[model samples]
Target chain A: MSKDNKEELKNDTIKENQEEIKESETLTEEVLEDIVEDEVSELEEAQNTAKEFENKYLRVSAEMQNMQRRSNEERLTLVKYRSQDLAKKIIPSLDNLERALAVEGITEEVKKGLEMVQESLVSALKDEGIEEVPVTTFDHNFHMAVQTIPADDEHPADSIVQVFQKGYKLHERLLRPAMVVVAQA
Target chain B: MSKDNKEELKNDTIKENQEEIKESETLTEEVLEDIVEDEVSELEEAQNTAKEFENKYLRVSAEMQNMQRRSNEERLTLVKYRSQDLAKKIIPSLDNLERALAVEGITEEVKKGLEMVQESLVSALKDEGIEEVPVTTFDHNFHMAVQTIPADDEHPADSIVQVFQKGYKLHERLLRPAMVVVAQA
Candidate 1:
């Protein structure tokens, strides 16, 4: 082949190599851009997953704390009202003993024995946070109005006139409201 | 400039361009490798964070469930033992009534009234899950061995001879262990 033709062919080959180099450089930039975009989306997805799990953890932690608080409150309330059921059952027997003491004609010995029993039972009830409903103001919360009477000057309006049966309470909880007569205007 | 010098200068320019292209190609490859490594490590870190959050969420959820279960159990126990405290307080009063009934020379009316009170109090206690501890066999759980007597055929070893003071129980709990004489060989 002629030297001129050989040189021309070599020049063509160099041009082709330069074009290939340019193409590869463009491809690198494109590939890097694509990779960065993919990485960003993947990182966002990972962050969303982490955030979701964190939210769930926080919610469950709050629920556990609330449950503990509620349980403690319930325990305190139960302990406070622990004697409620037994006190209710014993109140009637106390009423019966009081009636027995009220009946006339018992000898001193019998009346004394009955009085001792009555005092002890009442004291036991008192020790357990049981007490008769106060007969001061006619409060519906503690006193049930079985009968109502006209308000006289002596018995002011909404005042308790008479208690038919005693009402007892265990702490703040009313076991049975006092069946009573109230004076109303 | 001379034609030969111009040709040589053009050749030097081509060579410089080629070397620059080669360096850029190598840098592109190095940059791509570093980017992929960085992406892999970042993804791993993200995944690790997500896994950590998931584990914490699971732990907290389990804790919440366990707390709820425990709270239910505690509530049941509280309800079951609700009457225990008041019943304990009332037992001594019951003992006093029993002693009052045991006294000699009381009139029939007084005796009847005392028996009625005793029966009513006992019934109330039974309704509230209070009961006299069984005196069949001497059990330390429900019976306190205050006195010991020599065992005979009539009272076998480990049997109960007599209860000094009656013991009582509220459900499975011993409110007071019976003071008893135990028969031992």
Candidate 2:
């Protein structure tokens, strides 16, 4: 071949080789970019999943704690009111004892015996968180007004005039409301 | 230059280009493999974290349910025995009423009133889950033997002769054991 032709052929071959190298490099770069994008998306999805789980965990944990607290409160209330039913049952017996004491012409010894028994019963009731409802003032929540009487100097308006049946309480809860006569203006 | 020298130079350049392409391909493959490994490990880690959170949630849920069940049981027990203390307090009053009845009463009206009161009180107690303990046979669990009487044709050995103070129960629980006299051979 002539010198010029050989030189031209060599230049063409070198250019082709450079183009192929550039193309391969670009292809490798594109492939790497695609792999990187896939990894980033996967990481983001995993992060979102973790965030979702964390939120659910926190909500469920709070709910569990709230339930525990509520259950404890209920248990405490149950213990406090444990004697309510029994205290109600004993009211009638107490009324009967009081009636027996009011009977006329009883011997001193019998009256003394009844008084002792009544005192012991009162103590027993007090020990078990039972107490008489206060009757100095009229409270609708704790007293039931069965009769209304005209207000007087001694019994002012909205005051408790007389308790027909004594009310009892177990702890903070009322076992029975006092049946009372209230004074009206 | 000779044709042979030019040919040799061109062949050497082509060989160098091929080696460079092979080297780039091997590097690309290694990098891709590393990226894939990283993604797989990340996915595994995410799955492990999710599993851990799920396990914790299940355990906490179970604990909360168990607490709820236990609280309910406690509440039921509290309700069942609610009248025990009150019934115990009323026993003394009942004893007093019985004593007054035994006394030689001069008036029939007083006796009748006392009887009516006693019956009403018993009914009230029954309504509150209080009942008298059975005393036909000697039972150590429900009866307290204060004295032992000689067995006869009427009373067999290990049988209850007389109840001193009547025993009472509130629901399934023993409120008071019966103070009794047992028959002995």
Candidate 3:
């Protein structure tokens, strides 16, 4: 072949190789970018999953702590009101003892014995956080108005006129309301 | 320049470009591999964290359920034993009433009233899960030996001869041990 023809051939070959190299570079860059993008997204998804689980764990832990606190408070309340039902059941018997004491014609020994028994029972009840409800201005929470009398100059409205049945309380809770006659306007 | 010289120069340029492309490919492969490995490890770490958090959440949920169950059981037990203290205090008073009834020279009316009070009180106690402890054979768990009598044909050893004071129980728990005379060999 002529030298000019040969030179032309060499130029064509060089240009073709350069184009091939450019194409290869572009392909490698695209492949690398695609792989990196896919990996980054996968890693992000894993991180998101981990965060969600962590949040759930934290929420449950807080709920458990709250439940424990609530249960303890409920336990204390239950202990405080433990004697309510039994005290209610026994209040009527106390009334009976008072009635026995009020009876007439009992001998000195019997009267003395009954008084002793009554005093001891009242003391026992008191020790158990049971006590006679104070008779003050008639409050419906501690006194039940079975009868009402006219309010006069001496007796104000809502005043306790007579306590027919004494009321008792256990701590702050009422076992039975005192059955009483109240003055009304 | 001569055609030969130009061809040699072109060949050199093509060789250099090829070498440069090879070098670029090696570098690209190394970088891509490193990035992929780093991302994969990060993903694995995140997945492990998520698994750990999930396990923690499950454990906490179970603990809460167990705690709730335990608290409910304790509440029921407290309710069952609510009357224990009050009943203990009242037992001595009940003994006082019995002593009052046993005295001689009481009028019929006084006796009747005393008996009525005692009966009502006993009934109230029974309703509150209180009951007189039965006097059978002597048992230290339910009886206190205040006096000991000689064992004979009529009274066997470990038998109860007389009861000085009645014992009582509230539910399954003893309120007070009975004061009693026992027969011993």
Candidate 4:
């Protein structure tokens, strides 16, 4: 072959070798970039899953705490008002005892005995956190105005004229509202 | 240059090109292998994270369910036993009324009124889930054996001879044990 032809063939081979090197380098770089991108996306997905679990755990924990608090409060309220139903039932018995005391035909001795019994019933009620609702003034919250009476000098307007039937309370809750007579102007 | 020298130069260049191409090819293969290894590890990590989150969520859900069931049961118990305290308190009042009824020399009117009061009291107690502990035989659970009597033909051994004081129960709970006289063999 001619020297020129030989030199041309060598240059072409060198150029081809350079292009192959460049292509291989680019391919390697692309593979590295793909690895980095895959790792980043995988990490992000794992992090998102962890974050979602954390949020769910937090929400469930908060709900559990709230339910616990509500249950505790309900239990406390129940304990505090444990005697409410029986205390309310006993009120009518107390009213009967008071009525028996009002009866005029009983002997003094019998009346005295009845008075002692009434006192004991009152004490039993008090021991169980039951008490008469105080109604010096007419308050709609605690006293039920059964009848309205004209205001007098002693009983001003909106004042309690008289309590017809006594009201009772257990703890802070009203067991029975006072059946009362309110004074009106 | 001589023909042999030129030939030698050309062969050296071709050999160098071949070595460079082989090196680049190996580097490219190594990079691809690294990318595949990185992706496999990343995928494993992601699976692990998801498994961990699933376990956490299941545990939290189970705990929350248990707590909810316990709280509901506690609330039900509280409601069921709400009248126990006042029922227990009213026992002594009932005893006093019984004593008053036993007294002699009272007028028939007074006796009738007292009977009515006792009935009302019993009704009230019943309304609040309080009932007398009935004892036909000696049961240690609800009856307190205060006195022992010799067993006769009429009264079998381990039988309740007489009730000195009535026992009462509020729902399933014993409010007061019956003070009784039991027959012995």
Candidate number with greatest lDDT: 3
lDDT of 3 by residue, A1-185 (tens): 98878778878878887897889889988998899899889888888988998999999999989988998898888877777776787777777777887888777887888888888778878887889999889998899999999999999999998999889998988888899999999
Recovered share of real interface contacts in candidate 2: 0.45
Alpha carbon lDDT of each predicted model: 0.85, 0.80, 0.86, 0.83
Instruction: Please identify model 1 stretches exceeding 4 Å from their true place.
Output: B1-14
lDDT tens digits, residue span A1-42, model 1: 875665566566568768877898899999999998898789
Clashing residue pairs, backbone N/CA/C < 3 A, model 3: none
Best by TM-score: 1
Model 2 C-alpha lDDT per residue in residues A1-185, reported as the tens digit of each score: 99778877876877788788889999989988988888878777776777677677777789988987887887777777777666676667677767877898766656665576667667878988988999988998899999999999988999998888889887777888999999999
> On a 0 to 100 scale, what is the lDDT of residue A36 in model 3?
85
Better of 1 and 2 by DockQ: 1
DockQ of each model vs. true complex = 0.61, 0.40, 0.63, 0.49
> How well is each residue in A80-101 modelled by candidate 4, as lDDT tens digits?
8877777777788788887777
Per-residue lDDT, model 3, residue A159, is 93
Which 10-residue window of candidate 2 chain B scores lowest in summed lDDT? B105-114
Candidate 3: where are CA atoms >4 Å away?
A: A1-16
Stretch of 10 with least lDDT, candidate 1 chain B: B3-12
**lDDT at B162 for candidate 1?**
88
True contacts kept of 3: 0.69
